[model samples]
Target: MRDFMDYVLTAFHHKTGWNVDNSYASLTTTANNLLDFNVPHGLSLHVSSLSSPNFATSYTLGSKGVVDGSLSFLYTSLGLNVTSRSSHIPLANLVRGYRHLQHLSLPKGKALNDVQDGGTSIAGDGRKDTLLYGRLYLPSSSLEALYLRRLSPNRLLRLNCVSDATLPSGGTVLALLQNDFGKYTTEYLYSTDSSLLGFRALYNFGYDPRYPLDQQHVSSRPARHPWDHQNGRLSAGAEAYFSPINKSGGISTGLRFTTLPIHTGFPYTMTLTLNPLMGNLSSSYAVKAGPNLSLCSRFDFNVYSYESDVSLGLELWQLSRPRVPEEVAWVKDLIRPGWEPKVAPEKVVPDEDVTGVLKARMTDKGKVGVVWECRLKELLVTLGAGLDLKKRDSVVGKFGLEVAYSS
Candidate 1:
């Protein structure tokens, strides 16, 4: 049954070219990634096996001689991660937001869009694509698990579980069901933590593939408008959540304008979100003005309190020219007349070329952060620092160095 569903979903995706970012919650993902810099606070080291992409270990030496270590394994569709001395680590580090793909790396030569095409296995790879995958995280004091399955081209189900000795209820579970209707998307969420129920919906003002065939008025389908090909797509959405136990509810609405992967022009994204109940309004704009530079800015305001702040972020890269002069042609072949561009063969980037990146962000409140990441001879190194201009003393609040090696 799962195999059949996966096949159907892949077929539908191929026909429509619907993208994962159409979901309501993903509207600001691009901007957030650029602006949300983690402030590293301790020495960290990570080692992995080059022979296998699935196994790795990490150690962090924090303040007061507190040290933490973890081991992780990934086999086919199953993932297991265990940590020791987690209680000794700072609670803030453990409770920070989690990114599902933080550790994911794309196979050589595979463009992000290619891998996102309905979860099909890469050609010639003997391993069959797994329709269901799960991850289990075990720490000294708590447990966490995530399971996800694809029900159809337009439907998905996810289950999340967390258990800890400190929790009053011992554990919490959350279930989420997402539906992609060609022109719109909807998601339903339930959480045991607060007896919360939520519903969210996103509707695209532009073209979308998830719309069912019966709903598309074939006879009245209009010819492509000039703007359809020249401008980006627009979408609007809202979410509402209620807690029966607390007898409380809240709602927020947002709008997004983003260029599709096929735009073949300067890429950009803009988003605006508002929470009327809290009188909070936020917006962001991110743009890739050039090949090696990108900029993002965000503004937040509270109507009730008359408070406002702005922040800016940027990413600068150092790239070397491709070694083979012929390979440079591929850059010009960005778009084919009517087909998706094929992933080019993996090229060996010159060791000295395409080396380093610098990402930094600053807020109006005088909080600033910067991170410089680069690839060394056989290791990847990252250096980061955080500062507060308002502080008379302790101007440099935190800083850290991280290094990773694979052998």
Candidate 2:
């Protein structure tokens, strides 16, 4: 009986190990991508070169006759961008931080390439490697730089600086340190802009020791319990921030529950967050309705202000089939004794098998948005539109087209 119980427990751990941990701030990433991505409102163009895959440029002309453009260079470890207008901070890097730690002690020749390609192999227990990454953004002559490094398999460090000519202090700096354990993760943050200090941590209630965020251990066994395979993971996290100069502070907490799509099972993710200091509550749910369809919804309420909002969004994929000619050479041979059609075969697109995606969102405040993105052989296209239901007098709303070409 004891041997049987140990086997059952090992099977359960295998099921939970299939999923990885999520950062505390990434609880709403799925919902936000579907409902909050910006919609283009005019003509836009982007071009890139295959020989120089790391470089690209874009230009946009809005409905209000405003023109803007940007040049960007992206690589595995370095990035740079210059634009006419400033934009928000990068949420994936700054807010969400690292999802996992990587320990690499590969040979010098293949170490960099392996890391870039996400290749894993047998190595020593600890990492004898050092990695440094940097990104720079220049908007309207202002400069912002971000740098990151891994101190060890369980620790990471990051620094960010923003410089503007008009600022009284000329610039501000922010720093972050992160540590990951098998069952939980923690982060510390400090910002010179506001003299703020922050701490955040996330813990998995059903965390499996075999598969931590770093994914150092893997198994090939199947789950004995079907229910355990479907209920992937559950996690809870909290964050608090305080400013010494202002003598103020705030705290927030959140929970996330998610399932894996195993053996054609429909999977879903749900998240709830509460900010007691602000009297705010928010929740979101995203589900894969079918093979080609996804749906998501979000709700927000402010208990003190008595304000509430709700939104829904969906994504659908469409695929086009190759066309067959009605009158082929073989078919024409039957009609004429010795005649063949002079027409040549249709040129097939190399990427004809590619599928297009359409996304739409609607809010309780009478705002609706639609976006369609598709790819041709060497070109990509995006169309977007937004409508205000309350404004009946306007026959049309905002719409835009964006095109990109690559060699």
Candidate 3:
């Protein structure tokens, strides 16, 4: 039971660990291809592939690069990007500072990677950054503090404080304070009767001030109304228990309300657990302004709306090997005696089939579409169509076909 409703199931008895493969490397190449088109203003794309894979490690390296618009005078951009992993640490000799009693991110693998990467990161006028973070935790005193500094990319500092206290009445209270040398955010949480009931509050002092003032809370104090012009924005909710702990399911409800401009809603959610079948449902009231964001079932809609991107995803595992076509078998037999093609049965991506639409989006309005894709060996075929839902005009319908080759 993790917060944010993120639950993962793992088999402790599996013979092999989870596979993390070259999918990320392939994605990096695809992203680089996309960057080659529609150049951003004051930016130029390099012809060479910047997202090259790092073969140095047992696995592929994670690569990222940036184009400096400020250095327009040079024909080429400054080298300000790096590809590294946690275990690849460098520059251990340059660290300075001492606090043995506190938690320190002093030397170790992280320091090594930062040192090696920092020197090569000369892309923009922004100086490279070397981080030094430390923390002191005292459980007996129920107190904690943290400090972090950036030696490069301009001097930057952050501070953190926390405290947790347990009352004789079997209750616990928590407080946290964090500041990044600019604004500060504070949070307080209280649990009564051993977490049967809980409450939390947050105040953000350094929020953006450009938003229109909340006329409803204009008279409220700064503590209650942290954002300018915004009235008191408070949220409260409750949890009810059902079934046995860890062996059953439960339900919970919450709400967030603001005084002025009239914004209020009840957040409803539930967890369904039944043997091998499990899922969670949730609702939010935030409006989505871009296609990249998922549409909220309740808030992302109005009287008139355009939802161009509808998607259906399908994946197949435990595939049955397809028999070679008769014609292909005949050709293979003619080439040699008992000739057969090779296959990597252990590869997650089976060789039986492949093909896809490559890419699609809701680039048009008032249209509904269906797409079908199949994979055959290293080739993928995709066929799809879109029809105007508002009208059945056959001539206005659209159909598309795409084929992809991969190895």
Quantify all predictions' global Cα lDDT against the true fold: 0.59, 0.55, 0.25
Model 3 is weakest, by summed lDDT over 10 consecutive residues, at 1-10
Q: Give the TM-score (vs. native) of candidate 3.
A: 0.22
TM-score of 1: 0.70
Alpha carbon deviation, residue 373, candidate 2 (Å): 1.0
Clashes of 2: 0
> Model 3, which residues run further than 4 Å from truth?
1-299, 303-366
Cα lDDT, model 3, residue 63: 15
lDDT of 2 by residue, 300-320 (tens): 999999999999998765647
| RMSD list, candidates in order | 9.9, 14.7, 25.7
- Top lDDT: which candidate number? 1
By TM-score, highest first, what's the ranking? Answer: 1, 2, 3
Q: Kindly list the per-residue Cα lDDT of model 3 for residues 135-232, writing each as its tens digit.
A: 22222344433333333221223333344456454323322222111111222222232333222222223223223234334445543323323332
lDDT per residue as tens, model 1, 1-407: 01112222333233333345658888778777678867666787755441322233332233414665444332323122222122222211221111111101112212112232333534432222222222333344465555555444456676877777788799899999987764688999999978999999988764444342334453354335322232457889999999999899999999988765445455678889999999999999888765456789999999999999999988765665635533346556765466434333322233345566677899999999988776666666678899899996899988988765544
